[model samples]
Structures are given as structure tokens and as C-alpha cells.
Target: MATLNKGILGGFSGKVGTVVGANWRGLDIIRSRPKNAKRNPTEKQLEQQMKFKLAVSFLQPLKTIQSMYFGSGSGVKSRVNMAVSYTINEAIQVVVGLPELIYNKVLITRGELTSFQNAVLTTQPGGVLHLEWEDNSTQGNAAPADLVSIVCYCEELKNWEIFEGIVMRSDLMADVTLPAYCLGKTMEVYAFLNNVKQTAASTSFYLGQHLVN
Candidate 1:
């Protein structure tokens, strides 16, 4: 119950007489070890701890992306706090819809299409993916040459397949061949466009998930 101010022993580690020294929150302190409690944690308390552990494990890998888009000039601690809060509030089972960070601008995460319209996906023989979309080049934000980026995730394999290429705005269709192993496994697809000249990117569109056939 005593706060050891710095000027005292200047942070002693190990046991010194009856006092044990340690560092906590960047501060040096000394305290006596308390006796272990006899009662175990309740079920609800254990569940809460499990949720926290899950959140940390889930968000650890996305540290780079979260810092890129949601840092907001704050340190990594801020982003971690946000991710933890979101995970707890929503009880997120799968991680998706992370916002894209481009040219210091944050774009929407939910993948709402704008310049591209009527996107459709169909599975062809041999597990080929046929993607078709209407070209709305007349949109003010549209450009003559844009880069299309597609990301698909195979939950069964815990793998992500990315495809990106420069395409003329007039083109309305594209195709991708799923790996033989990915056939018949449900996969989620997301598509977005990047205007390289302007260094801007469009909001991603979630094309939904289905078996590749």
C-alpha cells in the first residue's frame, strides 16, 4: 500500500531483507509478496480472461495494418486498445474488412464499391473463377487506367491469395484460377481499385464467399 518514490534505494531487484524489489509500468518499486488466495476464479472471470487472450492473439499479426490505418498519430498502444475494445464489443469470430491505408488516407473497410458496378463471380470448370463487373468510367472518380486488386482467403487452409494488375477502365471482366486444393472449399473474395497516378484507392467490395467448385 506504499508508493516508493524514486530517490530511495534507486530500484533494487531481488530480495533485500523483508522487501522484494521489481519494476512495474516503467517504475521501480518494492513490496512484500502477499499470500496466495485459496479461492479459484469464477467461470465468468475465466471466460473473460479467455476472451482477452483471444483478442490479443488475433490482433497481434495485424499490428502493422492497424498501425498504418488506425494509429492516428498515436502509438501502438492506442491501436491495441482499439482492437481490444472492438473484439470484446463485437465478439468477432473472423477477422475481415480491415481498412486500407493508402497515401496517408484511410479508406472504408466494409468494401463498398463506387466506380465499379454490378460485380459478379461465377465458378467455371476446373475451379476457375470468372469475375464480371460493369465499367462506370463516367464516374468522376474513375480513371482511364486503374489497378485492380483482388484478395481471397481460404479459411480451411488459413491462406490468402492476392492478385493485382493494371487494367483499362473499359475492361469489364477478369478471371482467376483457384488452386486444385482450394476447389470445393469456401473462400471469401474482396476487390478494390487503385489509381496509381493519384495515389488513391477505391473502397473494397466484399464479393462474398462460396465453394470454388
Candidate 2:
């Protein structure tokens, strides 16, 4: 910080280049902008950053689905934000000094809608995924018109296949045809149900990893 007598630029009172000019007690004052402090993050902060990175990377692929099906999306936080918060707090685990996402605990959707019952997933030859579930749609609050959505992630190939409303809950079964590139890759599969009106969704079910045939 320095005091300026205004020799040439008659009473400058704003920022110009690297210095800031202002009037202070009938005197022009010039001060350099404060430099940003670059400090190493603490151990806790580093762990949190790692966890956030892992959560975001896994959820980013299903961002669109999350925005529509994660929670109620009625509070101060958006559905995507809710999903990220839930993932960081509930779905991530620390192993070997680094954060890793737990596949079975990770949820792609959440709501009051009824989810799958006795769901079974198997792969047929040529990259076909066969999903079978009990027809519990007529029970309780479940509706036959509930839409089924599937998500497949291939970590080795870094590929995603997201299918929304491909089948109905009453259908009891679904077949997801994967792309040719996913034929040889092992895939982590998940399924969820949302109402036909798209107002709510059930918690996603992890169908486990399957070696594509």
C-alpha cells in the first residue's frame, strides 16, 4: 500500500493495472491487490477431495437420469446435488488411503415408488442382458404402468449404456442389447423404476457385474 499525491493522473479513484486507487481521509491511496495464498490441502481435505472426485466421476455419466429421479428435487438442493451428497456420504468407501465407490451401495434414483422384487440378471450370447423380476406391480402402491430403466457401465471400456422407460413393470422381464464394443467387457448393471408420469422413482438396484457373452 502506498499514498499517491496524483502528480499526473489527476485523482484516480479506481483500479488501474495492478494497483487499486481510493480516497482515504482527503488523500489518494494506492494498494496492490492481495495475492492468492496457494497452500497444500490438509490430510482430511485431501481425502474429501478424493472422495468427491470418485463420486462425481461415477455419477456424471447418469447425470440426466439423476436430475429427474434422484430424490424429490423439491428442497434447496437439486436432484443431482442430492445424488452427489448421498454418494459422497453413503456410497463411497476409503480403501488403501484412497476413496473408492462401492458399486452395490451406489444409487441412481430414490423415491417412494416400488422397486424390483426378486430381480435376476443374466447375459446371453452377443451382448444381450436378460433381466427378470417378479410382477409385484399390483401390490401396495406399485403400478403396472411404472417404467423400467436400465444402466450398464463397463469400467474396462469406459462405456455406458443408459436405457430409460424401455419396458413396463408389469412386463416382468427386459432385454438390453449392448453395443458391439461392449460384447467382451464386464459390465456393472443397475435397474430402476419410475412412474409413467415421471413424478417419482424407486431406489436403483445393482444387479451386479456380468461378463458379457
Predictions in order: lDDT: 0.61, 0.88
Best by TM-score: 2
Model 2 TM-score, 2 decimals: 0.82
TM-score per prediction, in order, is: 0.57, 0.82
Model 1 Cα displacement at 165 (Å)? Answer: 2.7
Off by over 4 Å in 2: 1-37
User: Which residue pairs clash within candidate 1?
Assistant: 111-204
